[model samples]
Target chain A: MKIFLHRRGFIARIAALMVLPFVAQRRAFAQSEAVDSLIEKITGGAPLQRGRVKLEIPTLADNGNSVSLRVVVDSPMTPSNHVKSIHLIAPKNPRPGVASFFYGAGAGRPQISTRIRLSGSQGVIAVAVSACWDAS
Target chain B: MAARISVPQNARRGDSIEIRVAIQHPMETGYRTDDNGTSIPKNVINKLACRYNGVEVFRAEMGSGISANPYLSFFIIAANSGELRFDWVDDAGVTGSERTSIIVAG
Candidate 1:
């Protein structure tokens, strides 16, 4: 009886060990999917490039609640060349669409600075669309 | 209550005008746990719009990513004396606005 009980205990421990990792992995995958869906909704199938928009964020955020951020687009603030909109996205935040800024020729600068909350360390993306440049 | 906007009392025409605004908010994310281990409801500013001289120049859609007491800075072309208005809304459907006038000079 003792041997039988020991065997059952070992088996149960092993089963738990196996199940825990799978559960954790599943949660992680779900989070990733959520973030992807948010990005898709914000961009509306627009291609996202790496270097067009400058996203200035701290390499390591001390607080997951509020982080300072600045987004600057490399566009002239002219009537024909100014940036139409700027989208700031945080993939892992509870609300992924952090902010969207719209600017016109009347806006003297194509830059925005504000404080943002981050759930954790994650990739921050900034998408800027201009009147002349095609969506990418 | 309405949000508060602070800008220079006088701005010169042809010079860049700096505008700053701060709103009182908690900007809570639903993921946070309270002292009793209960999840807090999400509350954040979802949108902010700024208009100068009756024309819309800048607008932003905010989210939980924005911190409490949100502060935003931007600039506008100083052309003529007019009013600068700021409007913001949160996820809970709460709205606030503030406005100030500037003296533009050539």
Candidate 2:
């Protein structure tokens, strides 16, 4: 009985050791689907590339009340190729949503500069989606 | 709600112009305590948008992290001469909008 119990304990320890890092990695990825789904609401669940979206914010912020933020997306402003919208998400804030920007063909470029509030230190996410539309 | 807006009154057609919008609000985060030690309710502009020539140009979904009296700057091509409209809404459902005219030099 003692040997069987000891083996069971050993097996459980090995199992925990194997799974801990993956759990740790998930925690480290800043995975906040809660805010991502908000973007999904606007995109209608279309596929999106995690590229072409740029966000500029201070690496270190002194105040949780307000922080300067800038976001940009690469796109041609032609009626056939244009950015549909841009959004900012702050996962740790009391309100995770920071901002959203919708761009038309007339928006020569997809970029914006603004100040936002942050309740604490967290990863900020920027996402942009584009679609073609007729000028008429 | 009154807002201050800036845009190039005159721009060559096809030229890109910058639009600036500044709105007035307290953007209360509801985290701070008043003189009576009661927690203030969170109130901030949750959404913002800019429309050019009656078409949507840019829109933003904001949170309490947004500063009081938010200021936003963005770009738009001078496609046709028309007015640019900026509008926003707070948590309390109060809405505000402002308009500025732009002359596209043909």
Candidate 3:
């Protein structure tokens, strides 16, 4: 009886150990999809290059009700070279699309500041499209 | 609802000037319930647009993820002296508009 009990315990532990990574990986993938797919949809599956957008938010927000947000993109703001639009995404929010800003050549600088709400602790992503990229 | 807009009184031509706007709103998320346990309907500003001298300069699409009393600050070039008009509409189909003028020096 004792041997049978010990063997059952060992089997259960082994099973748990084997399944842990898979479960964790699935959870991570789901979270990534929530954010990545939303971004992809906004960009229309366009390839994204890094280093143009700069998003500023409190590292540790005191309240999720209203958090200040600022986004800056590198652009000269001329008729030919300017930022087309900026999209703000909060993955953990019930709706990921926080806000989207469209700009014209008259926009002197590619920067904006606003307030947003968050459902929980998560990273905020800002994507900026340049006017020189495409017609649409 | 009332909206407040601020623009520089004067700016040199070709100079960049800051513009700030704030609106009075609840921006209800519809996720909360009252004492009766009845959920509140979501109502937030869905779109805002700014026009400079009848030319569209900036626009924003907002969702429930924005906080109550939405406020935004941005920059625009003082190409000409004219009016800056802001128009916005909320989920409840209510529209609000405000205007401010800036003087650009030559």
Candidate 4:
């Protein structure tokens, strides 16, 4: 009876060990999906081109409560071809949307710097929308 | 609520000048418990707008994710000699503003 009980307990432990990774993976997948939907809502399903917007944040922040962030978008900042807005998002924060900056005709270079709070370690995403889409 | 705005006193017309603002606020995230174990309600600046001589030039919408004592910096083209006015409001309906003049040469 003792050997049988020990065998059952070992099997149970093995099962739990096998399920742990999948559980973690499912959680990670859900989080990325949520971020994707949020981005889609902002861009209206527009294709996100990856080369123009630059997001700078600390790779290993000592403090998660407040971290400095900077975003620079490549734009001429002309009257007709300027960045209309920039959105900062933190996927793992209590509130995902960090901030949104809007620029008018008087805006010059498309760049901003600010401080943000992070609940935990996560990737920060910066989205810059231009007033007019550039083919080049 | 005290706020500070930094802008160069003089800039040539068509020059891209940087503007910075730092304000004092708790930016309570609604996730913190006080000494008595009462949850602190969220109160952060919701909207901030900047106008150049009565023309809106920049605006921002911030959330609780912003750290306390929010600081922001951006660039704006110096068109003419005028006042750069900043107006912001918080979640508790408190409004604050600060203005500074800049002289544009040439």
Q: Pick the candidate with the highest lDDT.
A: 4
Worst 10 residues of 4 chain B by lDDT: B27-36
Q: Candidate 3, overall lDDT?
A: 0.75
Candidate order, lDDT descending:
4, 3, 2, 1
- Cα-based lDDT at residue B106, candidate 2: 83
Q: How would you encode candidate 2's per-residue C-alpha lDDT over A75-131 as one tens digit per residue?
A: 666677677777777765666776766675567777889987665556677766666
Give the Å shift of residue A27 in candidate 4.
20
Q: How good is the docking of model 1, by CAPRI class?
A: acceptable
Q: What is the lDDT of residue B36 in candidate 4?
A: 83
Between candidates 1 and 4, the one scoring higher on DockQ is 4
> Between prediction 1 and prediction 2, which has the larger lDDT?
2
Write one digit per residue (lDDT tens) for candidate 1, span A1-136.
1111111111000000001111123222223676657545654544444444666776765555567777777766676567777777776565677787888657877778898766655677676766654322
Q: What stretches of model 2 exceed 4 Å from their correct place?
A: A1-30, A39-43, A132-136
Interface RMS deviation of candidate 1: 10.1
What is the Cα root-mean-square deviation between model 3 and the actual structure?
12.7
Which lDDT value does model 3 have at A113? Answer: 98
Deviation (Å) of A77 in candidate 1: 1.7
For model 2 chain A, the run of ten residues with the poorest summed lDDT: A10-19
User: lDDT by residue for model 3 over A1-136, one digit each (tens)?
Assistant: 1111111111100000001111222222233677767666665655565556777776766667778878878776667667878888776678888898898768878889999887766667777877553223
Badly placed stretches (over 4 Å) of model 1 are A1-39, A133-136, B33-38
Q: What ranking emerges by DockQ with the best candidate at the front? A: 4, 3, 1, 2
lDDT of 2: 0.69
Name the lDDT value of residue A39 in candidate 1. 49
lDDT of 1 by residue, B37-62 (tens): 88877788888888888888899887
